[model samples]
Target: MKQLMDLANRDPLARRWAKNCAFDLMFGVGDDHYQVEVRGGQIEAMRERPSKLTSWDFAIAGPQSSWQAHWAPVPAPTFHDIIAMRTAGHITIEGELTGFFANILYVKRMLELPRIEGWLQ
Candidate 1:
């Protein structure tokens, strides 16, 4: 996750997409879960367990495999696909959905960065 975040921070497209945006990432691992929130590219909050708060501007959640698969290819996965899967119970999210779909291309481009690919172990 640090590798991915580092790549995102250095990406021009990611920087543009993240400008003034708050993001939260939730991952499920067996009986335990973890969440991290980023505001203005810096970690604002992090926690375990679910909360009623929906303060983020965008949110993404999934198991490790699903999350990793999003960075597997040059184009990566689309927001539409991720949302669709979430809606179908394959993933889960809570927060504002606005602008997230619009920035899918930017997220994909960020995943395609050379530094990102190099850290894919």
Candidate 2:
């Protein structure tokens, strides 16, 4: 989670578009659960909770092992594509989809951050 925050903090694009947005991540694959919060493109908080009740303006869910694959650069699997996938049942989401497509470019730029290079691989 620190790594993700580091990436977001250093990302010019993330900083730009996250100006008024509050995003959260909730994931778990057994006894371990992790939650991360990002507001104004910076990490506001993080923690490991026994339950996954954390909320945010947006959220994505899936196995942690799928992170790299889901984030990998692909011609059709861009962040927008991910959102579509989630809506189509390829993945799962627990938030609003409105205006999500409008933020695709910003999302792409954030994914290009160097700190998150490993996740993209």
Candidate 3:
């Protein structure tokens, strides 16, 4: 995931897309969780969840299996999207939604970055 962020930080398109966005997104894969901090469209940090009381704009969590499928080169139906994963009960999204919605495109594109380089495969 750190690699993904690094690559994204160097991506011109990604930077442009998220230029005005800023937030901390908590992403969980099974028992592990990461806090991805974004400011001005650049991924400033990707690290383990800081603490229970750490403030985050929103969170996206799911089992390892769900994420594996979602990151597959050719994701199966419903596994191809975050909303679909939520609707399918494969993942849960919580916390403040305004930030998530406001930068929905960036969130989706950032999560899908792995697909571009086939990193998860």
Candidate 4:
């Protein structure tokens, strides 16, 4: 997944997707979680955490199936978007959400990199 994050720095469109959206966030699958810190369109850190230490602007969690479907090259219906997943009860979002909701498009695009780069399939 770090590879997917790193790809953003190399993509003009991806970098732009994160413009003015600096913040820390995490993704949880099963019991393991990973934090991704972004600053100025660059990923400062993307590491797995045993447990939460500090807070995040937002966090997204779901079952491995949801995550896998999300990383599909072309997802189906509910898997196509985070909001869709949440609406369908396949994923959950938490924490300070104003920033996340405001930049949902950018955040969504950033999260889609795993599939965009063919790193998941």
Best by TM-score: 3
Report the Cα lDDT for candidate 2.
0.55
Q: What is the C-alpha lDDT of each candidate?
A: 0.54, 0.55, 0.88, 0.81
Where does candidate 1 stray beyond 4 Å?
Answer: 27-33, 41-59, 74-80, 95-121
Q: Each model's TM-score?
A: 0.52, 0.62, 0.93, 0.88
The residue pairs that clash in candidate 4, if any, are: none
Query: In candidate 2, which residue ranges exceed 4 Å CA deviation?
Result: 23-32, 50-58, 73-80, 96-116
Judge candidate 1 at residue 80 and give its lDDT: 28
Error of 2 at 49 (Å): 3.0
Which candidate model has the greater TM-score, 2 or 3? Answer: 3
Backbone clash pairs in model 2 (N, Cα, C under 3 Å; residues 3+ apart or in different chains), count = 0
- Compared with the true structure, model 1 gives a TM-score of 0.52
Q: Give lDDT: candidate 3, residue 4.
A: 79
Stronger candidate by TM-score (3 vs 4): 3
Clashing pairs in 2: none
The digit string of per-residue lDDT tens for model 1 on 39-107 reads 775445567676756344555556655554544544233522555556666556555655456555553
Candidate 3: clashing residue pairs, number: 0
